[model samples]
Target: MTVLFWVCTIGILSLFLIWRNHSDQKKAKERFRDLKKTQYGASPNRNSGEEALSHVSHFFEDHRQENAIDDITWNDLEMDSVFARLNYCESAAGEEVLYDFLRNPCRLNASERARLERQIELLQTDGDVRLQLQYQFYMLRQRGKFSIYDYLHLLDQEKKRRNGKHFLLLFLLILSLVCCIFSVSGAPLFLVGMICVNMITYFQEKGRSDAYLSVFYYVLRLLGEAEKLERIHHERLQETFALEL
Candidate 1:
């Protein structure tokens, strides 16, 4: 009877998980369609263009790296419209990286550029590969405008602020469990108390860490996307994907 109950419980949980995943995928697809419509209709006016240009200056100043393209070059080349047309990226990271690529075009050698062009041509022709990559990216879309890089840059400060209360609480909980198992008087009550204390501490710590949650979420997504991209049989993307990984 116990085995039957356990089997039924597991089956029900599996079905529920499948249903939830299907529902989430449906919602994501709907959102993707709406985004496509918006992207197609988007037209940045003079004011909007100026605003985008201003933001570009900040990225340049914040991240001083080589091969960075200038805003003037992008504007002169009308690459913003070009990017909008080609921007099928579904993740925040993918979109940001694509924007950065356009703003600061990579200084690829002639052979590398030719190889990349070939890969682009292949990507254009391969609908299945494109769709697979798009689906993966779509699932990684973040809920808010959180910058992974900015939060990562502040990791040192965050680490410095961390106290060892969680570790102490965990140690106490383990000791309480051992005492309860040893059949000591009042051990059960002590164990329960420790559990409550641990729960409270967990929530408090979780609340404190909530600010970094979105940043970490997007970073995980970025890593997942990079892993998927690496598996694609494209030599041109191998080095770039390696750098990302």
Candidate 2:
């Protein structure tokens, strides 16, 4: 009866989660459509804190070239608010890239400028292709409090993670399995104890590495979205962006 109850509970929870995901996706699509049609004015940038906003700027600040916009000019233009107005990006990573591009203001040659203009036109007119791409971007929501680049920087400074503890845990689990065949009662206790220890250790490592893991996950998501766009094969988009991904 308890087993049946758990099975039923799991089924219900799975259904609820699926339903919630679909509902969220529908809402996001609608919101994108509405914003595109109405041309909503930009509000102030979402600031978790001064520290977080600073972290978001780290990449652009660190990588400034000779031609990059000067701080004085940027502020004089109220570039932050201008960025807020221009940023239709769905992901924090997208926002970071846009910010960096604006900061570094590249000089596009005639061909490049024409290509960019054509891509912009496609995005404006091709609703289906635009929506498909936007949906993928929407899935990669903002990472509050810190940018992915910040997490990556932290990872670079940290010592490389070792697999020794994981190997030890696996060895113990195998030993416990062997003991189960020889001594059932003793083996059960040993196995349970080792399982508990493994759980504790796993959680400890996960807690310590969560930031690093999230950064990698976010990057993988961006790659996946790019891959999705590549598969779309929209003729005009192909000619314009020339997505090589």
Candidate 3:
């Protein structure tokens, strides 16, 4: 066979394999999201879940109506309440309340949601959140380059690395992978580079759950060959809720 013919054939096969893998991964993600909706009995990202999760309704019902939280500021109390619930104790009772509130998720106004996000940021500004997440990573360190905690900490995700060292390492990995690919057409150097890049990107986000997911994905793929996946709690992903896990 001609050299060009072989090159074309190999290139086509590589493209086919890469595309297949990507399609499968995306499908898995969609299926996972749908499963979550079913299990939580609420739609993803919808506040409907929060409404059903409220525990205060009963308490407040017995109290005088004048002191009841009004529509405009109830969201604030919810934010504070979630924070207070998380920080003060790692109690299942509190979590049950959160779940109840989230089950019929309250419709937090856009401004209110943004405010809560800021509140989460301020709370995490001290760095304890990151450390606890890190400890989770180290605990699951045996799972190769990734960890279970990575899937749970989107807020700790590493940013895409832009540093000179990263670029240099990436360049070297790419060069070596390219040389190897052409010389030994069956190996997966490009995929290796992708794995490295994913890890780097995971760490760059630092405090994101996406970072944790990156590590989780890496570990699962490299070690566990895991098929099941779940999202971190909304608070963990957003730094909004304190968690015992």
Candidate 4:
């Protein structure tokens, strides 16, 4: 009876979680669409501080070279204000990419420039593709004051964990659940012990690699969205992205 109760409770909770996630995602997409409609060509309303702006520049700084704009010249040109004026990205990653583009103005030849212009033209004209890509980026939304690059740097310090113990614990958990169903003597106690051990192991692993886990999730989300982008079926956009689908 207790096992049945637990199973029912877990099933209900899982359904609730799935429904809530779907609801939230739908709401978010609608909100993003409304915002995009209202804010098109409008001046940016985001208040960017020096620290926040600096965080966005981490990727650019990391890959910056001799031809890149120097700090003195960047400040002299008041590029921060310029960045804020032009910034309309829905994610930190997008902002970082834009920042890098601005800082290292690519020396494109005539053919390259024409191709880039055509890409921009398509984005401006193709509302469906534009909104689709925007929503994907919006799904990759920034959280808090830190950029993805910040978490990525911290992730470098995190110790990598092997999956062997995790798999073993999972197998043991399943075996214990089966034992419980068969009404084996002391099976309930064994199941409880397995649950406790699993909880402890999970938290210990999370504590050790919280940063790594966060970054890994972010990267996975990014890649997932990129894959969706690749499936958009626009030949020009596919060429522009140059992603191997």
Best by TM-score: 4
Q: Give the clash count for model 4.
A: 0
Pairwise lDDT winner, candidates 1 and 4: 4
Summarize candidate 2's per-residue lDDT along 74-189 as a digit string, tens digits: 98998877776677777888778778878987745688778878888888788777777777787788887677777777777998878997999989988998898788678998
Would you list the C-alpha lDDT of every candidate in the order shown?
Answer: 0.65, 0.79, 0.47, 0.84
Off by over 4 Å in 4: 1-24, 107-111, 150-208, 239-242
The C-alpha stretches of model 2 lying farther than 4 A from their native spots are 1-52, 107-110, 153-157, 162-204
Please tell me which predicted candidate would have the highest lDDT against the true structure. 4
Model 1 lDDT, residue 217, Cα? 71
lDDT of 1 by residue, 1-245 (tens): 99999999999999999999999988877686565445543552222243433332333346545767676776798877776665555655555566666665654678777766776765566655555566667777643444455566666577555458778888889999999899989999999999999898889878977868867776777677778766777553454323344
Task: Write the candidate numbers in order of decreasing TM-score.
Answer: 4, 2, 1, 3
Listing every candidate in turn, what is its Cα RMSD in Å to the true structure after a full C-alpha superposition? 7.4, 6.0, 18.8, 7.6
Query: How accurate locally is residue 38 in candidate 1, as Cα lDDT from 0 to 100?
Result: 59
Q: What is the lDDT of residue 154 in candidate 3?
A: 43
